[model samples]
Target: MIEQTKCNAILQKEAESFRNTSRRTFIKRLAGGTAVIAAAPYISCGKAGDSFEALKESAGALSTGNIGDEAFWREVKKQFIIDKKLIVMNAANLSPSPVPVMEILFELTRDVDRDASSQNRSKFSTLRQQTREAVAAYIGADPEEVAIVRNTSEGNNMVINGLSLNKGDEVVIWDQNHPTLNVAWDVRAERYGFTVKKVGTPLKPQTAEDLVEPFRDAITNRTKVLAFSDISNITGVRLPENELCAMARDAGIITVIDGAQSIGAMNLNMHDIGCDFYTCSSHKWMMGPREAGILYVKKEHITDLYPSIVGVGWEGAIGSGTARKFETLGQQANERIAAFGKTVEFLDAIGKDRIEARILSIAAALRDGISKRVPGVEFYNPQNREMSGGIVKFASPEIDLSDAGSTLYETYGIVCSVHGGNFPGIRLSTHIYNTMEEIEKATEAAAGLV
Candidate 1:
């Protein structure tokens, strides 16, 4: 590990570099001389300020090769305000925002509360655009193709309601998709007289083709849309999204990907995936503020899809001929939107590929540790990292699911998702915030339940 003083110096240097780059980008965006002067305070201070300096510093201190070093990750974990007593492994459902993101959120919220005047709030417009651009660049999409919506549900519905489906048209989806992408389609199909088919994959997939073939067989001549999750939140199955999207595209079908699980946990490029539409929530794996999400609409389909909400600024948004039309929901929480950009910056500083590798490592460790210690353990998720991401779902026949979940929390201070009914197991979705030591303790706790 680098010395503390030297690390601090490196962090400060990186932070200054980030600030300079941001200033240049902001100034370039506002090319008008008077507009730059008017936006100077917003640029130099609150909007493009030091909100993410701590995050950048922490990430910059670590060498690229030190991604697997526990010491370096421990420093990264310190950037979050999670309770010291609790081990949070539920990044699929939600994640605690890091200190930098929360700082920006609180700072902006206080600013809004202090002065609700239009003049004071004008800076948010520019900040929102910056966030849109950041999200676009992060996911490898054009700025005009990204919309800052409320959450995955809203993004899902935007495409669900936006598409022009008719009777005899079929939409093929995975059975494991979240309700927003699953039931939402059924609800829409009921009204429109369209068909919604749910396809299921093998319980234990051996290869990527095992997952892709099922969806391939489900599509037919009448299939107009192919909707599925990049990673199933329940079973932790990572689908062959690029192949699936390419298949749908070749068949002249629109592909809608619910990226609730994969967006932050994995490194993704929307263009490479070749999906017509993609949706994700920031609060889950991105660790941004709640109720903030992103909607990606392919530029060619921008005019084809209708806007779900037509509130204030609908005319200009429509006239813009971009994905902005999908974000016309009025009276948004501007503070949360601004903080979402900070969350992106935090992830970018750490590097998405490194975060993905760390997440997969912890997941594999937890899975291996549990399977070795606990007898007759059943894993719902795939063991191979190629077919999985950060999620690991398992249950022992001897222990009740609810009791195991409660005991894991109450006795071990480990918080994970518990499922009942059809899938009775505990789901542990780890992230960069988690440590190997915590996974070992959790493994012991699971064994004790037996």
Candidate 2:
């Protein structure tokens, strides 16, 4: 274990670099949020006397080698509070928070419950803006361009509602986009009388060019926004966002991307990504609170797009009005949302570059293990590492996987989820905390089921 406590310090330093870049507006919101965190009661993770020992303990744990270095991953496993009897392979559904994030959650909840101040009431908005600043930096976007939403559904809704196209305008969506996001567009399209074009993304495309052509082919004069999941949750395919965005830009079409699978798992820059809008929930790979999500829109589009829920003066550019307008439904898990700052801090500690590399390393191992175990496992995502993110989809031809997937966890005490979508499979996802051993264990059990 390598004590990246040094790395943690370095991460904070790097995060400080944002101080110069952050908009004055986001800084004010974050400062207010930090003040709230300061007033919050301190919940001891352990005895006060154990602080040094805890540091030493953490230092000892950090000295571990590569995650697959079996000895190292075992210790890494200790930070989580998962059921010892059950193995959790389903990070896609939700990941268990590590000690650090949990500690933050515990403290924040205590403060919100203990105090009745304007600070706590207003801090929710501030915390979200701060979180967006960090996330936007990680994803290569400006803080002003980002809005903290509840989930991918909410973020997607912002884009769907913001778009000001006419009744005949068309938007492109993949058949395999997450149901919540895909359906949001469908519901709005019907209401606004716009055309919802389902571009047929093939299960296994030969190359990046092949994977993107479906959307390109569907473009028409009325096709105003070309949107798709950054990486389809069901198929586990990483779409070419920059390429598609460039193509759309040439045609005067805007681009919207669902980063549910891509955002935290991969290092994405919104500006470099060439998309006009992007949406992702923090819970999944970001490992933040479930109801907290974010939306990014190009600065120019903010004025053009309107908020869905209109009431009580909701106006500003992207994430304007402290992003309060989008919180149409009132009084949220305020503390949980604030705790998202801690999640971002942890990720910042690990380094987004390290995390991007770490999760993909685990994903590759699972892909190899699943393929070797079941030759007939349908590999829907692009085989190229660059074309996939944290998700790896595989279904056995010899077994009825749709039904068998649920059993993979229930019987084996391994946690995972089954997908019945464009490319049916046992959708296996992993995050920073997931080691190769767990993936191997989950794979072995999955192989047995097949």
Candidate 3:
């Protein structure tokens, strides 16, 4: 304890000294060449001083550096086990977990497997609470409002099934919602005889109002729910969530936000957004283990929604009525939940603002590269920062986007999403792990195809 306190004191002094350092120099130095992982980036809870030192060492790779510096992100990329031979740009679908998260996941899983008993596994209950608290803090919500679940789909469905609806009650949803949020409502509407109205926005939204006005105009007296995605995987349009949520609240309607693509890639404050319900999959932008998710319900409305799946943990006690009641699904992968806490811890160590800036920087670089190199490149994603994020979608009449994904992978070992239909294009999602070098190479590969 003495040694840990001394280390923290030293770290605090160092941090104070570095406060005046230029932001550019900070990013440049931090983005220095990849260094060996000496420790995970966590210093609290009385961990050994060496652990703190190790975290500092690991963080050195991302030390004072600019987001445009390939050397800096290249170091950040080293923390993952992604293949060096491939240029993976599909953060919209999945991301690789960092070394610390994977390590704890394996270690705890092995410990559980070695002795699966009430006596040995009792700590997981506390760990689960810690997980919820970590996720809650990350999203700026109360721990009681956060429910650890399986994925975005499950969370969305929980809100869909938990809410009370009746015949002729209309739910307004954005047309660009993921199938889970879009089709799941239809399934329930079919059985319950409610109306599902999907409001459409222009493919290339010119402004935030272009995205917001459609949903704002869609609401009516019968609109009981307004469900939408903060960032759409299909069109890559980032909705004006705060405006939309406030609109719903004013209309006395519930708001359910599918944050599948927004949570980890951007800085989010659930309370500030004031949505009634929010759901996120940790596997995508969070780079946590699969089958892990988070569900946030406003404290006021927790009692109004029913638990979609109730089992061993379900209780009639007042204490049980919290968001925990919503997570009463049978036995869960406790190891993943434990690892998820580490995932949140890792992200916290890096700082969400830093992560968001890095992602946007790379996406901007990609857009600029494609426009300059690829002929007739037409972007589907809104160029405005308010209506777009790390996901960039574009197409060229000279190239066939339907087969662009396979071709990029086969020819250049680059992985990206290719969307077909009315909006046929290639989608490249940049995260902290991606590099300027990879983005440049992808642009070159795309130019050749054109």
Candidate with maximal TM-score: 1
Range of the 10 consecutive residues with the lowest summed lDDT in candidate 3: 29-38
Q: What is the lDDT of candidate 2?
A: 0.69
Reference-based lDDT, each prediction: 0.83, 0.69, 0.81
Summarize candidate 1's per-residue lDDT along 12-40 as a digit string, tens digits. 55345333444335434332211222222
Q: Name the runs in model 3 displaced over 4 angstroms.
A: 1-70, 316-318
Candidate 3 C-alpha lDDT tens digits along 183-288: 9999999999999999999887788888888888889999999999999898788999999999889999999999999999999999999999999999999999
On a 0 to 100 scale, what is the lDDT of residue 386 in model 3?
82
Model 3, residue 279: displacement in angstroms? 0.2
TM-score versus the correct structure, for each prediction: 0.88, 0.82, 0.86
